[model samples]
Target: MEFWLRVTRSQITKEIRAGRTDTWAAFALVVRLFREAMRKRAAGDERLWGDLLRYAQDVVDRTPGA
Candidate 1:
């Protein structure tokens, strides 16, 4: 199998199945994604970043754990 470091649903799963993905790296990407979403939705001061993290965690949780 090929080694891909990119962060994507398919790539992550493939790497995980192939025993090539780093758990920290995948979680870091998730955190970065949550940050990006929060950065874009900068509206009236509200707790959206936490929500984004929760949502991202939910998505990760749905997949097989590391």
Candidate 2:
């Protein structure tokens, strides 16, 4: 989980630094990634899913003008 969070943060930061300011696009990307992770997990682990959601939310919240 820590590793995934770090990777997600890095990706988001890179996108923002590249001037990809479309919040909706970023949101969609996060959602897609979340779904992919969920599929890979597929173990009925709510805690993991919740943590991932929280991390994604944190990124979105920290985004400028998001």
* TM-score leader: 2
Model 2, residue 55: C-alpha shift (Å): 0.5
lDDT of 1 by residue, 1-66 (tens): 233344455666777899876955976886787677667677644467677767868988988753
Using alpha carbons, what is the TM-score of model 2? Answer: 0.37
Give the CA lDDT, 0 to 100, for residue 43 in model 1: 62
Q: RMSD of candidate 1 to the true fold? A: 9.3
| Residue ranges of candidate 2 with Cα displaced over 4 Å | 1-36, 40-42
lDDT of 2 by residue, 1-66 (tens): 899668777877888889886844877886797787787579766776778878868999899774
lDDT of 1: 0.68
Candidate 1's TM-score reads 0.36
